[model samples]
Target: MSTLPTGYRTVVVPPERIEELRTVDQLAFAVAPDPEADQLLPFPVPHDRLMAVESPDGTYAAVHGSYDLVMPVPGGQVACAGLTWVGVRPDERRRGLLRAMITTHLERSLERGEPVSALFAAEAPIYGRFGYGSAADQVRLTVPRGAALRPVAGSERLTVRLERVDPGRHAELVEDLYVRAGAGRPGWVPRATPALRAYTVGDPPGRRAGCEPLLLATVLDGQDVRGVALFARKASWGEDGADAVVKVREASALDPASTHRLWSFLLDLDLTTTVETPPLAVDDPLLHLLVDPRPTRRRLTDNLWVRLLDVPTALAARRYAGPADVVLEVTDVLLPANAGRWRLVVDADGAADLSRTDVDADVALDVRELGALYLGGRSAAAMGSAGLARGDRAALDRLTTAFASSLAPVCPFMF
Candidate 1:
């Protein structure tokens, strides 16, 4: 456990003190409040999860919150604490306030039966020391308008409808399509609460950075909506001609044809010279359908950082890709309970049994590497090669195969 600074204490922020909490966040992040945005998109952090570090004089020195998230893993989902809204007052830096809050987060999450925690790191370097691992990578693409996609079987039959987004009418539909599109993919966390759902569709004028109001485009097959894209266009004029840029906030499809059709419409919008996408799964259908990807300006960024608070429970929650029988010596600094050797046995169906054992270890790794491999997106062999994991060569190869994911893990949106 991390020790708090002298004369500092932790406390749960009360509902009446939300403004005070917001003030701390605003000061920490250096952002001015937009009352219109807050009124349109309610804050998603639950009061029960809002915690702060109070200085000796009772002023908030730092704040953090977590979401009761059900995160998808290989072949299943597990209870997860989605860590978010972490901020420390500028004057409180290097005082161990962040470390103290993390200790509290892990303990409270485990008490709530969550064995795993995930976050979108504001800075990539901040969380690894706390046992969080970068488990997934997301891609953003900037494709020139009129770029062609390889044809899909039924793409021509799908019809497209584009209109201004009406959150009141489209929020539920967008959320439903999001759930279906991300089915069977690891780390796909749905908007489980009304506040989160509202946040997804909310487009207050203050939030638009000189772009048009949000737009909704749906790919339909008869009466069935097979795909949807939420986007906005920022108009521009150049010496040659119109150079508007279409920025897609979210895009998902139920089928290959829908995927092809959705991007086709998005990439060929009139008056738009470029179309940019939000972060997408590494194996997203759009990538496979693009005729040539070399020209698309791609940016790959770390998506989800994962921490296994209860190693045994977290390991058992996800299925393996293949049968495996091996002993692993895992080390965890923050959570000593997980630092030990364990035997993991997997059946043909990928179901795993994890228990403490006194057997000789076939592999040795830190809890961070284990968390990285938890979603099956990262390779054991790579970690072993980097010296982050130590294991027999054959064992490393086998572990890589068993832990590989058929679909690349992705968290479509930041928490």
Candidate 2:
């Protein structure tokens, strides 16, 4: 690990200190322990990967952990160390404790053969300096009830069923449908752990936020389940009329018809004047299905931040759009080994071959920008225009075309 501040030290958290870990997080996030939630949802972060910073007196000052995740990329997936549950005591603010923990996190992740690290940043600006770039964006939309959709063939053949969500009975179905829905899309990671699966459908009464118990609606074709939506409605009576809002926790469908059928039910639910959607990819099928999208209130934000710990492995893990041979000069502040020039050679099959080279660079950018482009969601030309990357027009165009994805990258569920 890199040198830490004076009087501060880092250590791997032991199983015995699980309560201490939770304590630090509770204080850091200002959340009180909910017994009902604890009973329904499992804490999934592995104890072995947990790390903590301690004061000279042996008190825990900060803590963090990583989840062993397989992140989907264009045409494939890669081993990703998902940095999560990061927290620091209020008194420990601005002491470089977080930075030291992140340094250790990267080093240990690389040692474990994870080429990339990804996270849902609690605060947007805290990660850019650490070489984590905003790699993908997600948008949420609020649509009025009865919004019309362009018809998709076979949508009328599908049927709908609504029932209360039961984690034990429906977790596997939700997981299966989710995987099928996100096939071939970059950054569409699945919940691999059983705890995460349970957490996905967990709905403790105390956590409802005044809404009714969670409900699950499925689109079916005879015996087969094609799509599912988890949602709830909070009733409200306004001067105008009943202004109930349907808030969707998540919605996934396997086919175009299923997508159309699923939303048709969601948008026309009785008593709901507005339907709030979960964060969706820019190219989500629902967007294309909407007859008119301009009227919806759309809010966009960064969804995922990626750090390329092993640049070559990370780059090679995903398929490119078109074949290209270009050299890149990559600058990585934390990992000097990733610094310097490299050549990326691609073939007609979209496969990549990367290696260190002394050849003059065709493009120059930091590892952060490379991470942003890793999943094929970001464009090299945009980075160049933003001054985050430097290169000639030809090289920028080539890189952009090589890395372009037919579908937008999105993480449907946050870690």
Candidate 3:
């Protein structure tokens, strides 16, 4: 366990101390606090899961929290501690506060029976040293309005409804469709609590930043909700006239027809010249449906950074893609129990069995790379080429084939 400096201690952040936590967070992130916005956007962290470093003067020097998340994995889901809201006051840098806080987080998460932890990194370079790996990537697109899509047979038959978002009425609907739409895809994390669900649909005027109130677009087939999109438009006028932009906050569709119908409505919004999408999986259906993708501007980014708190449990939680018998020599710096040889044997049924072993390792990698390969989105051979992993050519090929996923893993929204 990491130790705090003299005169500093870690403390559990209670309800009354939330303001202090927020103050430290705002200072660290360089964002001004809006009380009204806070009232609308529910506090997402549970009190018991919130923690902070207290200075000698009783002020919070740093703060962090986690969400009890059921993170989807290949063929299953695992109890994941979604690490979030991490911040350290600028004046407190290099004091080992962040390291101490992370140690506490890992220990507490493991104590609570969460074998895995995931986060969307504020900065990409900070987490790998702590054993978190860049596990998945998401893509965003800025497409011209009226962009064409190849038609699906039933897309024209489904109808769309657009209205101002109502958290009371639409939160459940949005959550339901989100869960169903991402049924088999790895890294699809749903809003698991009432507060999280409320935050998803919440809109405060102060947070709108000149855009219209958030809106919901639903695609329905005979009163059955087939898809949903949460979006907002910012009006603009230029020499060309009425060149507005549509920004989609989150979108999910259960079927190809629903996806086609939803995008058809979003792309043709009156006065909007372009539409922006939220983060999407690399293999998202919308990408394949676009008739001409060349004209769209695309940005790819790292999505989820995964860490294994309990190596054996985490590896066993997800099913393998193919038959395999291999031993991995994994090194974990933060958690010493994970630093050893682990033999993983997968049968034809894709069920994996992992046990401690002293046999020769077929592959050697750090726990960070293991986390990267955990979701089946990354290739062991590719990491080997990058020198992040080591193995012979055949062993790397066997590991890659056993871990490949047909669909790219992505968590569409940041925690």
Candidate 4:
């Protein structure tokens, strides 16, 4: 573990010190406090998982927290420490307080039997130095209102209803549809706790900047709910006419017809000129449903940054894609136990077994690259071509085939 500077120490943040922790993050992130929002939105992080660095004056200098999450992988799920709310006050910058806090977080997470850690990086470059790899990408689209969609078999029969979002009435419906929508996709993390669930549906007044109150759009077939979308419209007007924009917070659908029905309603809202989609997988169904996608504006961003704290356990947790017998020489600066040659053998059924090996490594790479490939979204051959991974050409091909996922990895919502 990295040592803290003299007279500085790591401490667990209790409920009473939650305000101090929030203050430190608000200062570091340069955001003003909104007490009204605080009352409406439940604090999502568990108090027991919050940690901070205390300076000599008995005040918090840096704060970080983790959520106990079950993250979906290629063929299964694993216990993941979703690292979040990390911040260090500007006055304490460059003092190694962040490093100390990270070490503490890693040790504590590992002790709790979590083999993986994932995060949505606020700043892209900072987490890479700490061994987190950019594992997935999400795209946001500004689709023109009234865009044409290719017809789905039953899309015409499904109906959409829009109403003010209610945690009491729509929380379970939203959560259930979200899980069903991303059934087989990697990195689809669900709201595992009540606090997280509440936060997802919470609509604090302070968060609405001139937009209408948050609304829920549900697609129904008879008595069954097939899809749900959380969104709001910001009113606007120009010389030409009403130029309102529909901003969707999140959307999920169970089937192709539901997806088509849901998006059709969102894209044709009254008085809206365009509809902004939430973070979507690169290969989202809506993209395929569109008759012409060239007119849509898109913004791509890194989605999940993954770090493997225990190499063998993490590797064994997720199934491989194809048959393979390859040895990887992994290097991890933060977790010394993970640095060594490990053999991964996958059977025809995609089950993998990773064990220590004395054999020559077929591929040699740092832990970051391995974590990036862990979800089966990244290609080993591409990494090798970029000189980020080193191995024979054929070995890289086999590794790529073994780790490939049918669907691109994505976490639709920020943690």
Candidate 5:
């Protein structure tokens, strides 16, 4: 067994005893694959996994994460330990383990030079207790069989190239080009990894079990990689086998020219018969480029999870779209200091009210959900439906939609 780190509880433990720290989690939330599970088989990121909350009787109560995230914040580069798998053991319910983990995580995040810490919340009403708010929205899109796309006639001379290169090689190629495409996007992590690279060009479209993805990429210049799209083709149970759907894994272009050319190329594939791209940003240009929007179906989901480690800093950091006034009543079952009524007033002069207040606000919600909602992943009305928000239904809807813009939140890189 390995000895605990400084300031950590003394317990007979192996390095893999990390999961036991999540005992509180086993008691509180759904059981699933652990996020801290050894960084997806290939390239492991720099991280710190540890137990934070412990019972007076010496039982480990909860786990908290502290990563090297945001050490380079101004450079937009930072190692982060977005708190995850947080819960209390079943026998230890109603205690303050969640609070302890959150407080500790935030302190460590800042201490480690991480200006920000993020997480997708498991419950809508939970994280506000920690002073977080919804930050983004994600769109789930489906392209029908024979669904076609064409640029406004006589667009630039169109061309496309598709091939299966060595996974290790192609992924590196894609990552090398990814940074150029990620500008001006929110909640996006630079997704470049050997595992992802291998998955990019590994299994073929045959039936050996791993033929899962159908990757289509193109280099507009006919040399340097510019645009790439990953998808899986499967036949639906219908009279026509021609009816198939291609679920896109990720798509990006170095520039508008590449964007238009790449999507147009994929949508026009005669062999695919059909294509589907899951949740997209409302601001995504592909929707506008499409000949028609009615044919495309949008499914909403909660992605880009946010857990605010620092209230003042996180609130002041994000760029807002329109000028509006909203006072939100925040609720948090996890963190008590964040549980209170507050005014979130955004004005026409581009000023925002993140300060405390004694008056009622226009809307209400948990801090975490608000962070996700802030990004437009969950609409104010939708939050209301989930019982996380309430206020002027019409006004709230207008403000939330306008704030969301057309861009749908998406983080393809899991970590």
Candidate 6:
């Protein structure tokens, strides 16, 4: 490692160097306090796919990433990038290496046409300084075998395929599914690279192998991929036998019959006792369809942890549909100085007071929470009960829930 920032180099991880990248993530993120990145890179580092900011001078810190995204807009499309692994050695902190690394990567991402970037933050307060916020919610669930779903007598035309999509072609299908589903919700990523797609479909041995994700597709009439169910066939997620579940990977579809068939199909697996799904939209019809809400395990968690790589753009890109006059206390560990309070007020339909202000803040939260609430992790009502929000709990609850997504967060893959 070089003594100074000079002579530093950036390279995509090579096929052989992938293991080294994993070692760095294991070492650096291990001590700094976030495991999200660590969990994301549990497999081999896709060096050919991995982007890194390394110190040729032998500086000990480096950052790694897996894929890029394309953000869809009303008029056009922009690139949305995904940053998987990020870490800087303790000795390297305060030297601005993380920020510099993100800046270099994001700038290049933009150059590559990526308009947005997303990550699952290990620490809630680390990304705000860069402008990322809680853009989505994630969940963990458990179900019972007694409540196992059985198809209602006779249903046809739905086929479940456990086969794999070739690496060369899975990308198109995964991206297709994500984009179609994402348009209906907030805090969703639209791109699905090969690694991410396989991770979603392939469940290896161990807890994940037991997952047994069933790649489902519903066809009405000829051959329309109207709906899909990315759910594991396994009984549950935890070790305790108290739970039985079919972990939902990810789904994309619009047909009502398709949705009905998908859920009902998973509910009726043999030998399984229960089902626990991760953060589900409070408004999802699936919730209402359940005969007993008590049997369903529901908990709020941040879906997509946001870390603002670029402040102004990150804040501006998202469309806020909440009540006006809500300032926030944004916090970040990577950029501690950005850890302060700010106001978020709306004028007309767009946002105002995005810049720093001395006004009274309405909602005070960390970036991770923002990511949680952004997607569906922390409900305004839940936050109110927790005392994070002073606004009308019922109103925020109703509104956010209405916006709450029916889609589940399923990233079984981390390439």
Residues 318-389 of candidate 5 have per-residue lDDT tens digits of: 545666656667775544555676656566644455777778777766666665554445577777777667
lDDT of 4 by residue, 1-415 (tens): 5988999999999999999999999999999999998987789999999999999999999999999999999999999999999999999999999889889988999999999999999999898877899999999999999999999999999998889999988788888999999999999999988888888888888888889898999999998999999999999999999999999999999999999999999999889899999999999998898999999999999999999999889988888888999999999999999999999999998998989999999999999999999888899999999999999999999999999999999998788
Candidate achieving the largest lDDT:
3
List TM-scores for all candidates, in order. 0.99, 0.98, 0.99, 0.99, 0.65, 0.62
Which ten contiguous residues of candidate 1 have the minimum total lDDT?
A: 34-43
**Candidate 3's error at 5, in angstroms?**
1.0
Candidates 2 and 3: which is better by lDDT? 3
In angstroms, the error of model 1 at 262 is 0.6
Q: Candidate 3's C-alpha lDDT?
A: 0.95
Model 5, CA-based lDDT: 0.57
lDDT of 2 by residue, 259-355 (tens): 9999999999988899999999988888888898888889999999999999999889989888999999999888999999999999999999999
Pairs of residues clashing in candidate 2: none
User: lDDT by residue for model 6 over 115-160, one digit each (tens)?
Assistant: 4567767776776556565654444455444453333322356554
Cα deviation of 270, candidate 3, in Å: 0.6
lDDT of 1 by residue, 1-415 (tens): 8889889999999998888888888988899998888777888999999999999999999999999999999999999999998999999899999999999999999999999999999999999999999999999999999887998899999999999998889999999999999999999999999899888888999999999999999999999999999999999999999999999999989989898999999999889899999999988888888888888999999999999999989989888999999889999999999999999999999999999999889999999899899898999999999999999889998889888889999999899
- The Cα error of candidate 5 at residue 357, in Å, is 10
In candidate 2, how many Å is residue 393 off?
A: 0.6
Off by over 4 Å in 4: none
Question: How many Å off is the CA of 149 in candidate 2?
Answer: 0.8
Instruction: Report per-prediction Cα RMSD to one decimal.
Output: 0.9, 1.2, 0.7, 0.7, 6.9, 7.5
Question: Model 5 misses residue 291 by how many Å?
Answer: 2.6
Prediction 6 global C-alpha lDDT? 0.53
lDDT by residue for model 3 over 1-415, one digit each (tens)?
6889999999999999999999999999999999998887889999999999999999999999999999999988899999999999999999999999999999999999999999999999999999999999999999999999998999989999999999999999999999999998999999999999998889988888889999999999999999999999999999989998999999989999999999999999999999999999999988998999999999999999999999999988988889999999999989999999999999998888999999999999999999999898999999999999999989999999888887899998789
| Candidate that beats the other on lDDT, 3 or 6, i.e. the better one | 3
> Residue 131 of candidate 5: its Cα lDDT?
60
